[model samples]
Target: MLMNSNYKVAFFDVDGTLADNELPRELGIYGRIPESAKRALSKLKEAGIEPVIASGRNYEKIADFAELLGVDSVISSNGTYVTFQGEPVANHYLSTELVKEMVEQFQTKQTDFLLETPEEILEYAADELLPENILQFLCHCPKEDLPSLDTEKLIAEKVAPTALNIHYKHVSKASGVEEILQKMGISSDQALAFGDEENDFAMFEKVGFPIAMGNGNDELKAKASYVTDTVKNHGIWKACLELELFEEE
Candidate 1:
């Protein structure tokens, strides 16, 4: 396989993309990165393509994983915080007023939720023990039981809740990727993105080539430019090989 210089950067979703969608037993611990996936990332680096972890997990949760994978750039917290090459690129936080309103609404409905900040995750009327690896804000609530928010109010306040329950109308994985692209002075057409969930839709829209894992959401697969194998079957390696994103040594 020959390297494809057309892609200068690759954005990778964490859960169900780079790592298996399994619950971890310990806090901040994640499933091992498949050896093949590691090799593929190395090859990308050798081919002069930057591989970045773009996940819904907060920076604190994904930092160790990123370090283990040897990737310095990351888009975390559903695009609320981003760092490129170990340098802060952007941090888009939910407005204080919006947070207060959401908290009140959640309390009124007795919904279990957690508030995520750059520093830590705060429990807000949550009853169950916090999971070792908390991915999103909403917890232990069924889709039907989820509290209804004032859509009009949210729009008027210029704030939107993401699929991951992140409240930031101006922030998303796409927005984070855009920041990195601008910093690298590369066009979106030169970027490749891989994702496996509904939250990843925004990211898929921002990239020239979008790949969906075999075990990914059906809707995501439909939007993907290419669909590869499951993460357990070394999908990252297979996709890079087929796309010629990196040369096999």
Candidate 2:
């Protein structure tokens, strides 16, 4: 199962991929990054593969995680924002109409939600609106209660909600990956990506090697080039090892 050594970059999803989806005891904190994951990242760097965090989480929320992982590149807010080498690459925002509509819906339905701005996450209704398993940028409302925004309209405007239900326009993890690839002068086939949720579909589609965690969604696994063990079992390390992305010491 050895792969080509041409992989120049590796995009990693946060929850359920690099880290467990469980929340820490501290409020608004994400799960800890495993030591094995850290070692896997180090190996990638040693192999000349640039590691990047590609997550649906907002930039502010994922900043600490990126620092902890020692990664300078990030595709955050489901690709609405991206950075490379600690420099801003691109930033897309939700349309004004879309924002107004969402705010109205949230107010009407009394749904608890948080609005993610460039500066900070603004609490709309109350704290803890997001589930413990998920991050803070999402809302806890039911599908039926969600705003009936026209799908065709969104497509027409190039606006859409991510798999995590966060609304943004004209961007996805795929687009973010493309941005970084263009900037780094690397082709899509020269990249690898790891993911466990539907939000990662775009990233998988963009990368040459898409590895899904064992605990990942069924559809994602079906589409993956390889499926490894769960995060708790050091899936990233195992997959990289099996693919011979880096030599074992």
Candidate 3:
């Protein structure tokens, strides 16, 4: 059990924690939240904890999963965008000029990629103009074909075996969580988080209770306060029950 049991909010990573995330199918995309996950969220809500999504998915791509799980707040593009109770709170897009320059570099290197924004995804081509709200870039080409640009100013997170989600360096699920908690007058002590990827490590470090899934990254498990079953094995349900996030039957 956690040392603190006064959680007011819950942050969930989408790809593996709350849903079955298999991409190239959902690369920078969200599939669906399983019934077990939905039930967990419902129970968490009954316990008076607000559920929010903290994912690398873009704002438009992460919505259906949020709607399905009956959640309102979403931190998407790895924290480049944020919304609370279905209201927009923040949008931290990558620098347009930098993105364009990177795209040019990709072309010069003959890299094939899919560019994504808060609005849509497009294949990177010299003639095509990037969206004004560009949030991420998914390079389909060889990883080496991608530029070796400094990540101190931006980010390049591997989203799939063949793709990477690019965003600003400061954008991470933890950043959004910190902002949300500050605005809500809540402390990290009042937040519990669950996730299953390298990207989720930051969140695990920030929350009071960090729960890692059985199918999650071993590194993440090493850093977790608690570890649960895999999503397919009812990980969310098990953790909720164990953590007392749900009432006894």
Q: What C-alpha RMSD separates each model from the true structure?
A: 5.6, 5.8, 3.0
- Model 1 misses residue 120 by how many Å? 1.5
Q: Pick the candidate with the highest TM-score.
A: 3
TM-score of 3: 0.87
Per-residue lDDT over 1-249 for candidate 2, one digit per residue giving the tens place of the 0 to 100 score: 868989999999877888876647353333466778899998898899999998766787788767877789999876777899899888776656666666677778876767675446667643434322221235655556556665643321122342235554456788999999998998989999999988688789998989999999999999999999998788999999999999776
Which sections of candidate 3 miss by over 4 Å? 1-5, 21-32, 124-129
**Per-residue error (Å), model 3, residue 208:** 0.6
User: What is residue 195's positional error in candidate 1, in angstroms?
Assistant: 1.8
Poorest stretch of ten by lDDT in candidate 1:
155-164
Tens-digit lDDT track of model 1 for 13-33: 887888776546353334556
- The runs of at least 3 residues in candidate 1 whose Cα sits more than 4 Å from the true structure, single-residue gaps closed, are 1-4, 22-30, 108-110, 124-139, 142-164
Span of ten consecutive residues with least summed lDDT in model 2: 155-164
Global fold similarity of model 2 (TM-score): 0.80
TM-score of each: 0.79, 0.80, 0.87
Q: After superposition, how far is residue 197 of candidate 2 from its true place, in Å?
A: 2.4
What 10-residue stretch in candidate 3 is worst by lDDT?
22-31
Q: How do the residues 87-164 of candidate 3 rate in per-residue lDDT, one tens digit apiece?
A: 878877767788878887877787776777766777765676667877777776556767877667876777778778
Deviation in Å, model 2, residue 57 alpha carbon? 0.9
| C-alpha local distance difference test of each model | 0.76, 0.77, 0.80
